[model samples]
Target: MSGRIAHLADVRGGYALEADAVVVGSGAGGAMAAANLARAGMDVVVVEAGPQVRPDDMTRDGPAFLSKYYWEGGLRMLLGSGAYPTMSGRCLGGSTVVNSAIFFRLPDWVRQAWIDEAGLSGLAGPELDAAYDRIFTRLKVAPTPMHVMGRKNLVTRDVLDRVGVPNKPLPRAVDGCIGSGDCLTGCRQGAKQSVDRSVLPEAVDHGARVMTCSQVERILFEDGRAVGVEGDVVDLDGWQKVGRFSVRAPRVFLAAGALHTPVLMQRSGVRLGGRVGGTFAAHISGLALGILPDDVRPWEGATQGWGGFSPEVQGLKFEALWGPTALIAAEWGGLGRDLSQMLQDVRRAAMVVMVYRAKTKGSVRATRSGMPDARLWIPPEEIHVVARQVHKLTAAFLDMGAEYVFTGVKGLPDRIRTIDEASGLLSNRLRGRHMTMTANHVFCSCPMDARADHGVVDPEGRVHGVPGLWISDASVFPSPSAVNPQATVMALSDLISRRAADLSLLDA
Candidate 1:
């Protein structure tokens, strides 16, 4: 249970903690496992590769920390068979700290869908619900108060009402949220109770040790069993060293997120049908932008308010999102002096919940032995549906008095000067440019029963060949739930951690 705060300059002669388990990636999944295992009196060591962002280190506005914490500078393009972007965070608490803090338990239908489609009976309705309740109680989640909806949520609510779309308040994990609305930037007020404030601290309290800035380069295996991990100490920036150290854990849990977990397994010489980085999705997300007349204060309210989907609504779904002044300014499309003018009006912008059913049309292939090359491209046919929903949603916003609309201005190839000109260039109107997007959720790569020929992990997130290695993150999400995935990930992870702890038999 004793370990040091891992930094870029740290090293070890052998397994320092030398205990029962080693958890790679101190995100939602790993933290949950560590908490359960440590509480059970198992010696647990949690390793992370990013700097620990403290309250003072927290910048209370914009997605300023986005570039700092996110992989690929928050511009990760998940090239579906069509093209788009999907970015994520890479800090100590990982993406959990940088997320919108909205916690939606897997809806009833999602669990049923997994059971019916992917054959994961273990994560069915009642059991999943019980797990959700446990994690929810542990995390102290609550709804975003109406009074704190801020200007953006208020305007979006009116817009949805006018369009006959129901907008509900979202539940978040924070306690005393005052609508600073910079959830993507990293919450500084200690208000957003992300994993750092919740599970990780709990794990630490239960005698778990966290090593920050320690980048795990690869999983080390001996005689086909996971013995430990190796990599280097990373600094504030995301850089790793060469010579690696090893730990000896009979149990190794890979929670390095969706993108890296598969790669890590592959590097460790474990091949479960070789579907390491395949079966990826990004919610095929598109942004909703509106140029309002009033000062909406982009940096107000919860970063993500609330949203739901409707078969009635076509390809896209609804979710309210608020941005900061800098991001709003960045989203403004134009050239030269005119762009400066739009940037000045950053206060008058509010965006809507927007996503079409993203396609599972890409793969994260190993670019080399230790690196991966993303082979993502969205489908062309889906763009019509994506654009249609966006157009309809924009109409609803315009009905609510939005003067100008810029659906994906940040993805636009060129800049538009006037609101009058924006109408001509919103949808298929895009430059056919493949932009990078990011979601905290990861799935399908290790699908339970895509058939053994292609799946990496089984329904229970256990590796097909490895004896004790298991995946409890979004990597095993058969298909994404239609909501922020924290609740689902935590619930699923909680379920798995309990199974790992039960130990009736270890090698499932």
Candidate 2:
């Protein structure tokens, strides 16, 4: 039961297809859902808005990769008092294609909280653990090997060890990482087990069809039930709409991501009293760069190889980060001469980044042009907390013999050589406007809850008051996950899709 991948050229000038189920967006959630449904003997079609970028086509060119895979060329921002930049992949595999392959299971505390507070009993007990075991086995999730964790990551580990923090080599969804430091781009070595390389391939083997460059604009409804979907077939390079495509199916899974799922629901005229696009949230991140005594060759190691934790800050954690020179240099803001020096110094620099669960909730609304307009207002106190995380990371690096630390807070000096300087710069009143941060882990837009008034979807991910349409993405999270959400997304999708199949819900 082998299936094939259909590119834009394959469906030019109007195409029509039929499937037992259609899953929109072929990232972690969609891919996992498709695989589970297909394995259950349902004919699945996965429609993705982006191109099918192969591993052979991946390159080290940062800008080129960003333009090809990232939404809005990696410059989409959450609009508010302070514009917080965010990145999500727009390619066949979605964000997993462009993100570091770190994988984390749903933390017990987060899961228990969701069950107790949101009444998400479906996520309770051993079912999710079983799903996680399957996904980890399928993706070969394992601790990153020390050999590929070059000096950049090892140095961060050393600092954590000296500080007596809980640190370990990150468990990543990679088979054989060569330490190319190109995870933010794409894995040329084809080692990163992004759904495109793992779950989607299994889905295809189970006869699930994949269509790239097909943007689902609207959910086709019949008698208040999702009957199918239709949208434009976009050109891979220019992104121009060259044709139209439609998929008819009994069930539809909206896994178009947190940012786009709500917009798609609104565009389809699915009314839920503003629940579809409300209550958006994201993980807030801040990074500290340290210049070491010797050239670390930061770009030669695993992009994100290690993680550190401290008991003092419950939801705060640190990760070692490295990437392209130009992208990393963007942290140090300046013109001509200053920027050039930072670029040259990047060879000896590495980053320790902190990501924390945000207490602030935002909203996503669809613009008239059919784009997602997302806004998250971070309170001044949250910014100060993030700055404290940044200060802690900077102090740790400085203590570990870093020549100097780059605290990217706007009001702070570019280079801080002492813990006292870092502390003074990150005082209690630091505002959100002073920090340059980015969030890729965006979710909770279409949260799941037992009560209809609280969320757009039910605890099982079925859209409230919408028949035959379900959501299988991070958008269904009732709250922000304290850890990376890819594994959680995939695991939940697998659970939901399998349960739906087992219960014969597609025909209901």
Candidate 3:
């Protein structure tokens, strides 16, 4: 609370900072690592690519938030068979600042898979448990109470109950949520405990300095060991470079998320072998709208309050979703009177989404100018499975007394009045071309594996061949987590920071 948070917007001329360690991000991973290192009596400097916008300055205006906090002004696209827009946070707190405050730990199966298949040791025992405990205590992870769940989440609970599926309240990293249904756009009430308000502040209190609007373009290595980083200080509006800055440290940590970390490494001339940017995976999702009998005001509740898994699909999860009126109107698929009518009845609209544990693989490459180019491929079999799962969800919504349902598929009718018709529509012709696929949970681009050819980092999160360089973000995930990964990323960062602290002590 008493340390430095330098805003480059007010800064002029070139600058330099010396620290024991330089952290290249300030999100879930970087903030946690910086806090731990500072607590271990190391001088830490955290360089963030985005501006530091306080919670009181946040708003419910979706477009304004996207333009200010989202990567590439919310226009980042992935290319392959089809083009898909990817959302990632570009702020002092990184993706955690703009994400739904869901806090899911690493699933048991995912933990076991990493241990067995990825050769990740010490991932399941008391070591990992202590890490989780520390992070959970810091973030105040808990479930949303029923009183704040609003009517929309209650409808989802009812549908799941009618269909004989079990559901529970989602755990969120919030303290005093008012259920404004604007978690995706950042919490305006300061109730959601993102890292910017939690660990990053703690890091500052412990003598860590945070540099906002400082983008690290490349890592500086000497004799095959990381020594520091260099980049430009950009303005908050256009992110245009205004001045050059540098940081010199004994160690460097990169927690720049899965999409951009590999690109940063490639631009820095670090060869992470063939697997640096390969093996990208995500939980592809589809959405459906249910026209309720009354005005439930879906946007009044917790953004995503309750969720459950179906017995039909092995790794599929269903959850209630709500968005802004403008976003909902765009998805309604009508014009003129029809669109106006739908917007007028928006209060009666509730949404349900299905997330499939996709088996597809993708890659991210660094361009000559240091930007990332992502290519994702969804297999035909996986597309069919998703289509079937979405059909089942739509049928359930229609059976639960909803007047009608709208599947967001392009070739399908705007609305389905009967369960049989929905089934036939999806079963007969649902392909990748018809459905729009987007993902928020991306992983395994720079995984941690014992095999040098398969991973970029070791189990301890140290970059394989680069001493004093470490990675402590979602990029270290050996595979898709099949759930929200903020908690997992934080826990792993705790472990990595502990290791880095010990190494720093020896060097001292």
* Best by the lDDT measure: 2
Q: Quick one: best TM-score, which candidate?
A: 2
What TM value does model 1 have? 0.89
Clashes of 3: 0
The clash numbers for all candidates, in the given order, read 24, 0, 0
Provide TM-scores for the models: 0.89, 0.96, 0.95
lDDT of 3 by residue, 321-431 (tens): 886666566557468767777875678888878777778789988987777888878886777887776676677778777788888777667788787767644555555
The worst-scoring run of ten residues by lDDT in candidate 3 lies at 499-508
Tell me the deviation in Å of residue 138 in model 3.
1.6
**TM-score, structure 3 vs. true:** 0.95
Ten consecutive residues with minimal summed lDDT in candidate 1? 412-421
- Candidate lDDT values, in order: 0.67, 0.85, 0.82
Q: For candidate 2, lDDT tens digit of each residue in 370-461?
A: 88999887887777777877776787788778888987787677888888777755577676677778877899999999998888988778
